[model samples]
Target chain A: SQTIHQWPATLVQPVGSPLSLECTVEGTSNPNLYWYRQAAGRGLQLLFYSVGIGQISSEVPQNLSASRPQDRQFILSSKKLLLSDSGFYLCAWSVLRSEAFFGQGTRLTVV
Target chain B: DQQVKQNSPSLSVQEGRISILNCDYTNSMFDYFLWYKKYPAEGPTFLISISSIKDKNEDGRFTVFLNKSAKHLSLHIVPSQPGDSAVYFCAARRVYGGSQGNLIFGKGTKLSVKP
Candidate 1:
C-alpha cells in the first residue's frame, strides 16, 4: 500500500516569512505529485504538478512553488508569505490516469 | 471560467434516506469524472469514479452517474448515515492528450445526514 505524509499539520507564520511544506510518498516510484490549495469557501485549486523529478507544471501563478527533489519527495516553498497565501494545502500522488490519493493537508495561517 | 461546477453549496438529508449530489462540467474534452469526500481540516479522499465510456459505476453504498451528453455527473448515497456528513467535491480530467493526470475540482457541496 502507498501512503503520503505531509507536515506540519498546522502552521502559523508572520508575513514575509519563508514557507516550506514537505510531502513524501512511500511504496511507489515515479508517481505523479500535485499541490493544491483550498481557500475559504472555495474549491481545491491546483498549484503545481510534477510528472518527474525536476519537471514541474504550474497551473495558477502565485507566490508558491513546488519541487520534486526525489522520486517520491515533493516540497512546496515560498520565499515570502502573504496574507492571501493562507489556505489548506494538500499533497496528492497518483499513477497515470488513475484516482489520486491525498495526504492529511496542512492548514497554513499567515498573520 | 470554472470548468467544473457544483451548484449546491450544501445539502441536508435524513438517515436511511437518499442523498443526491450534482455536478456539471463545461469542458467537452473531459473523459473521466470522479467524486471525493472531505472533512474539515483534512484532505479530500477519492470516493468513486466513472469513465466517460460508462454511464454508472457503483461501489458499496456510493454510486456515480455520468451523462456525457449533458456534461453532468452525480453521486448518490443510499441509506445515508451520519458518517456521510461531509463536503463532497466533483472532479474531472481529460484522460487523453498531455493532461492525463490533471484533475479539475468543483467548489464542493456540504452534505449533512442527520440521524
Candidate 2:
C-alpha cells in the first residue's frame, strides 16, 4: 500500500519568517506529487506539482515554492511568510492519472 | 473562474436515509471527476470517482453519477450514518491543458447526518 507523510501537523510562526514543509511517499516510485493550500471555508488551490525529480510546475502565483529533491520527497518552502500565507497545506500523490492519495495536512498560522 | 462548483455549503440528513450531493462544472474538457471526504484538521480522502465514458460508478455504500451533457455530477451515500458527517469536495481533472496538471477542487459541502 502507498502512503504519504507530511510533517509539522500544526505551527505558529511570526511574519517574515521562513517556512519549510516536507512530504514523502512510500511504496511508490516516480509518482506525481502535488502541493495544495486551503483557506478557511474555501476550496483547495493547487500550488505546485512535480512529475519527476527536479521538476516542478506552479499553478497560482504565490509566496510559496515547491521542490522534489528525490523520487518520493517533496518540499514546500518560502523565504518569507505573509499573513495571507496562513492556511491548511496538503500533500497528495497520484499515479497514471488515477485518484489521488493525501497526507494529513499541516495547519500553518502566520501571526 | 472556478471550473468545479459545489454550490451547497452544507447539508443535513437523517440516519439510514440516502444522502445526495451535487456538483457542477463549467469546463467541457474535463474527462475525470471525483468525490472526496474530509474530517476536521485532516486531509481529504478519496471516496469515489467516475470517468466521462461512464455515467455512474459504485463502491460499497457510495455511488457517483456523471452527466457529461449537463456537466454535472453527483454522489449518493445509502443509509447515511453519523460517521458520514464531514466536508465533501468535488474535483475534476482534464486529460490535457490543466494548469500544473493537477485536479481542480470546489469549495466543500459540510454534511451532517444525525441519528
Candidate 3:
C-alpha cells in the first residue's frame, strides 16, 4: 500500500521568513507528483508538478517553487513568505491513473 | 478565463435526501471529467469520474453525469448523509497520448447534509 507523508502538519512563520514543506511517498516508484494550495477550501490551485527527478513544472506563477531531489521526494520552498501565501499546502502522486492520492497536507500560516 | 465553473457556492439538503451538484466547462477538448470531495482541513479526495464517451458512471451512492454537447457535468449523491457534507470540486482534462496531460479545476460548491 502506498502512503504520502508531509511534515510539521501545522506551522506559523512571520512574513519575510523562509519556508520549506516536504512530501514523500512510500511503496511507489516513478510516480508523477504534484503540489497544490487551497484557500477557503473552495478549490485547489496547482503550484507545481514533477514528472521525474530534476524535472519540475510550475502551474501558477507565485513566490514559491518546487524541487524533486529524489524519485519519491518533493519539496516546496519559498525564499520569503508573504501574507497571501498562507494556506493549506498539499502534495499528491499518481501512477498511470489520473486520480491523485493526497498527503495529509501542511497548514502554513504566514503572520 | 475559467474553463470549469461550479456556480453554486453552497447547498443544504436534508439527510437521506438526494443531493445534486452541477458543473459546466467551456473547453471542448476536455474529454475526461472528475468530481472530488473535500473535508475541512483535509486535501480533496477523488470521488467519481466520467469520460466524454459515457453519459453516466456510478459507484455506490455517488454518480457522475456528463453531457458533452452542453459542456456540463454533475455529481449526484443518493441518500445523502451527514458525512457527505463537504466541498465538491469539478475538474476537466484533455486526454492525449494515452493519458490526461493536465487538469483544470473549478471553484467548488460546499454541500451540507443536515441531519
Candidate 4:
C-alpha cells in the first residue's frame, strides 16, 4: 500500500523566518505530487503540483514555493514567512488521472 | 471564480438516518468528481468518486451520484453514525487539461451525526 509522510505536524515561527516542510511517499514511483493550503474558514487551495522531478506548476502566486527533489520526495519552502502564510498545509500524491492520497497535514502558525 | 461549490456550510443529522451532501461545479470540462472527509487538524481522506461516464458509484456505506447535465454531484452515507461527523469536501478534476491530476476542491460542509 502506498503511504505519504509529512513532517513537523505543527510549526510556530516568527515573521520573516524561513520555512521548510517535507513530504515523501512510499510504494509508488513517478506519482504526481501536490501542495494545498487551507486558510481559516476556507477550502483547500492548490498551491503547487509536480508531475516529475524538477517540474512544478504553481496555481496561486504567494510567498511559498515547492520542489520535487526525488521521485517521491517533495518539499515546500519559503525564504520569508508572512502572517498571511499561516494555514494548514497538505501534501498529496496520485497516479495519472486518479484519486489522490493525502498525508497528515502540517499546521503552520506564523507569528 | 470557484469552480466547485458546496452551498451548505454545515449539516446536522440523526444516527441511522441517511446523510446527503450536495456539490455543484461550474466547469463543464470536469470529467471526474470525488468526495473527501476530514477531521480537524488532519488531511482530507478520499471517500468516493464517480466518473462522468457513470452516474453513480457505490462503496460500502458511501455512494456518489453525478449529474453531468446539471454539473452536480452528491454523496450519500447510509445509516449515518456518530463517527461520520466531519467536514465533507467535493472535488472535481479535468482529465484532458494540463492540470489533469490537480483537483479543485469546494468549501467543505461540516456534518454532525448525533446518536
Residue-wise C-alpha lDDT for candidate 4, range B35-110, written one tens digit per residue: 9999999999999998899999999999999989998899999989999999999999987767555899999999
All candidates in order of DockQ, best leading:
1, 4, 2, 3
Q: After superposition, how far is residue B43 of candidate 3 from its true place, in Å?
A: 1.4
- Stretches of candidate 2 exceeding 4 Å from the true structure: B96-101
Please report the TM-score between candidate 4 and the true structure.
0.98
Q: What are the RMSD figures for all models against the true structure?
A: 0.8, 1.4, 1.5, 1.0
- lDDT of candidate 2 over A21-72, digit per residue (tens): 9999999989999999999878888899999999999888999999999999
Please give, as one word, the docking class of candidate 1: high
DockQ of each: 0.83, 0.69, 0.58, 0.81
Residue by residue across B58-91, what tens digits does model 2's lDDT show? 9999999999999999999998999999999999
Q: Chain B TM-score of model 2, please?
A: 0.95
Backbone clashes, each candidate:
0, 0, 0, 0
* Cα error of candidate 4 at position A51, Å: 0.6
Q: In model 4 chain A, which range of ten residues has the least summed lDDT?
A: A37-46
Per-residue alpha-carbon lDDT of candidate 3 for residues A1-111, written as tens digits (9 for 90 to 100): 999998779999999999999999999999889998888744788889888999999988899989999999999999999999999999988874477888888999999
TM-scores for every predicted model: 0.98, 0.96, 0.95, 0.98
Q: Per-model i-RMS in Å?
A: 0.9, 1.6, 2.3, 0.9
lDDT of 1 by residue, A33-83 (tens): 999999988899999999999999999889998999999999999999999
**Which regions in candidate 4 have their CA more than 4 angstroms from the true location?**
B97-99
What fraction of the reference structure's interface contacts does model 3 contain?
Answer: 0.52
Question: Each candidate: what lDDT?
Answer: 0.95, 0.93, 0.89, 0.95
lDDT by residue (B13-111, candidate 3, tens digit) is 999999999999998988888898988778788899988889999999999989888998999999999999999999887775564356678889999
Residue A61 of model 2 has an lDDT of: 94
Between 2 and 3, whose TM-score is larger? 2
